[model samples]
Target: MTQTPTPATPVHWKVVIDTADPHAQADFWAAALRYVVEDNSALIGNLLGAGAVPAELVVESHGRRAWRDLVAVRHPDDPYDEASGTGRGRRLLFQRVPEPKTVKNRLHLDLHPGEGRREEELARLEDLGARVLRRVEEPSGGWIVMTDPEGNEFCLH
Candidate 1:
């Protein structure tokens, strides 16, 4: 007799992007996606008080303490770990790096702002420091490619 297979469980994950300024990227992405920047000030304070984290590794961001080399943005309605300020749902983590982006991205996000609203969304994104790379029109459909302030590519459909 053949045995039935068990259904696979979904894994929790976050996309990590390298950048010169993690904080700035986090801010930009948060605004662009209507997400919220995770506030880990309480966790940082606790770690500092316990001597688990060095003071030099923390910096003041938006009047609160954050990791000097990394930051994240998450959907506003997602659940998060209160103690760590980590999102349990959709999230994007930006890590600081010394090098700049010099080539095209292997992975990118495609945004759908609803039908008949692509132009409006594109304008809003442009106002947020994104630049139009090109526009693609095919018989099947079309989309507008854009680059964020840091040169990361994304699509508007």
Candidate 2:
């Protein structure tokens, strides 16, 4: 019998969310997902020292330097680039946008805390600044639709 060839490695990518405040969104998401906020301060400092980036394009956040227009959060267990602080695995990047979110999201996250723990997870998320939009009860199952502080929609399961 011949063995089948293994498929190519999946591309590593990150989801990007547009927001008016990237750091705030990063903080909220980091808490909600039990993830870590990416620390790009060292990279920023290096760029600034080399005159590769303008001081006006950076900001002080969490007592450290950060990009004024973007920030990212990554799964706690994911590998990251030491030189750039960029995640090599699961990640979400939030970028500054001029306009606020005016419409429903074309893509949204569905969080599953565990079996029989939706209510507790919902409460925790609410305390983290998530607002419930509605609850859905279908014959198959149920879920609660929520929005983050920036109005990006997500669901709890």
Candidate 3:
């Protein structure tokens, strides 16, 4: 008899980004990706009521309570924990950093908006405060590099 190996469990993860303004980054990313910003007001309220969280550590975002140093955005259709408003799938967490971004990103997001809709999507992103850095044309295909409001680099292909 031969034994079949069991598949490994998938790891859960969220991309952590350093930003000078986490709330603004969260808003920009949420709009750019058509995702929803996670709201943790209920959890914060519970913690505050229990004296488990400091009031100064929280801030009002979208008129709701959120962590002052961090914010996240998640795919609208992804499963989330109702108690904490945290996503179980694709998500991005932006954390506050004291210093500004002064160099190119070592890793960046690459967006695919479909075959021929790249230009349309690019225009929409520009309207959302993204500026085109440059356009790249290669033998394989082409893409447009862009910088977000705070200057983080990303590409549209």
Candidate 4:
């Protein structure tokens, strides 16, 4: 039999969040997921210098330059490009839009608080501005369905 080689592709994935305030969503999600907000200063600077982006469209966030219309959070341990300031691992990108969410999310994240700290973790999340939507139980287990300040759904399991 002949052997075949698998194609090599970078492990890349992003969660898109619809929000009226992308910066606020970035802050809330960064705290909730223990992730770091992407620092896009280098990229933004390059873009501005090259006439790709307008100066009015940039803002300072956490003492770093960021896009005014969108923001992202990335896994803290993931490798990132210091030059471009982009995460190479798990990331959540929040974008601003005028429309409100009208249906249940087709996809959501499950946060594993583990063992018996679910209530404490839930409280912590609430402190960070995540609202409890409901509690769901199943024969196997149960989880708390919650929404970020912007109303994006996530499950604490």
Candidate 5:
């Protein structure tokens, strides 16, 4: 008798982006994706109290203490670590980088608003500090390329 192989489980992850301002990037992305910014204040407080991290390494964002170099946004319906406010599902993490973006991205995100709301969604995103880079139309479909406030590219379809 032959036995079928078991399927492997998928790994959990969050996309990490390098940026000049983590908090600002987090804010923009949170609003754009309808995600919530991860609130790690409780854990930050504990770490501060224990002297595990210095106060100089933290900053206030959205009225909460956040890492000066890192912030994240997560899907609203996903579960997270209560102690650290870390998302266990779909998420994006932004970390501070010394240099600005110098070239086109090797990877980017594509968003689909629905069957007939692309224009509305594009406008909404633009109001949130996204700049339209170009519009592309092809035999298969059409899309608009945009860059975030910090110049990270994403597409609206």
Candidate 6:
């Protein structure tokens, strides 16, 4: 007799992006996807008051205190920490880097726009500083390949 194997427990995952400017990328992506940028102001404030974080490492974002070297955005519909203002689902974390991107991304995001709104969404993203890299087609499917202002590749399917 043949038997199916038991499914493994799902593990949590987060997408990490390398960038010279994390804040800018976070802003662009947040607007493009209608996601809310995570507000760690309370945490930052506490750290600052305790002297755990240097004052120079903080910045004013959305009229609140935040870390200067990192930021994250998440789906607006997802559950978030009220005190810290961080999303619990579909989050994108941006961290600063000293060097610029010089190679193709081995991993990228594929956006399924759904139905006939691909062009419209693409246009809107372009207006938000995304550049069209190319249009690709295959026997099985097709999509518009684009890059963010910082040149990180993503697609509109």
| Model 2: worst 10 consecutive residues (lDDT sum) | 97-106
- The 0-to-1 C-alpha lDDT of every candidate, in the order given, reads 0.95, 0.95, 0.96, 0.91, 0.96, 0.90
Candidate 6 ranges with C-alpha deviation above 4 Å: 1-9
Candidate 5 lDDT by residue in tens digits, 12-37 = 98899999999999999999999999
- Residue 86 error for model 5, in Å? 0.2
Ranking by lDDT: 3, 5, 1, 2, 4, 6
lDDT score, candidate 2, position 20 = 93
List the lowest-lDDT window of 10 residues for candidate 5.
Answer: 5-14
RMSD values for the candidates in order, in angstroms, are: 1.6, 2.5, 1.6, 1.7, 1.9, 3.4
Residues 34-98 of candidate 4 have per-residue lDDT tens digits of 89999999999999999998999999999988999999899999999899888888999999899
10-71 in candidate 2: lDDT tens per residue?
Answer: 98889999999999999999999999999999999999999999999999999999999999
10 residues in a row with least lDDT, candidate 6: 9-18
Alpha carbon lDDT at 40, candidate 3: 94
- Where model 4 places Cα greater than 4 Å from the true spot, the runs are 1-3
Pairs with backbone N, CA or C atoms under 3 Å apart (clashes), candidate 1:
none
Question: Against the hidden true structure, what lDDT does model 1 obtain?
Answer: 0.95
Candidate 6 residue lDDT tens string, 130-153: 999999999988899999999999
Runs off by more than 4 Å, candidate 3: 1-6
Error of 3 at 131 (Å): 0.8
lDDT of 2 at 86: 89
Worst 10 residues of 1 by lDDT: 3-12
